[model samples]
Target: MDQNSAVWLLLVTALVLANLPFIMVNRLFLMIKVESKSFIVNMIEFLTYFGITGIFAYLLEKKVMGHVAPQGWEFYTIVFFMFMIFAFPGFIYRYNLRNYLHKA
Candidate 1:
């Protein structure tokens, strides 16, 4: 495979590997537990969990990508976009689909 194809494969592989459980099961689990809570409470709980995960991912990347090199704004911009992309599914789940999918 060409370099571009290989890179795309790796990115897709990593995203699916990382996100499948969160998409299929973890959200279900959280919804069950958080259903009794207020929306803001649930949102804070969810965001805190993900924020910590993001911090850990950032730290791991910093180590793996090397510390001596200062990452550019483009790097953070990409990460910000990634965070938004990763959040889209959950946004749909909680805001758009939660009430429809699981009746109170």
Candidate 2:
């Protein structure tokens, strides 16, 4: 794939995966079902998705460019924040909006 397509793929993947922990089934990793999930559990799952997204991005970048670029702490910091922002809608819906739903 080309660099531009790879970049868009990574962004889209990050956006969807970032929300999975908050918005999907209580099951972890879409397996290992739980009766309920706590904040900490959700966070752990969220971080797992983040790691998955990172690996996916790495592979795509490597494939597109034939090498992986070195990244500094600042790059990671910004990317982390971008992931968090991508998750904002799901976070709000799960924590803030869900309670308001299912009410008469």
Instruction: State the lDDT of candidate 1 residue by residue for 1-104, as single tens digits.
Output: 35465445545544443333334433433445322444455455555554555565555555555543567999768765675576566557656687688885
lDDT of 1 at 98: 71
TM-score of each: 0.44, 0.93
Segments in model 1 whose C-alpha atoms lie over 4 Å from true places? 1-35, 68-81, 102-104
Q: Highest lDDT: which candidate? A: 2
Residue clash pairs of candidate 1 = none
Task: Point to the candidate with the largest TM-score.
Answer: 2
What lDDT does candidate 2 reach at residue 12? 90
Residue 92 CA displacement from its true place in model 2, Å: 0.7
Candidate 2 achieves a global lDDT of: 0.87
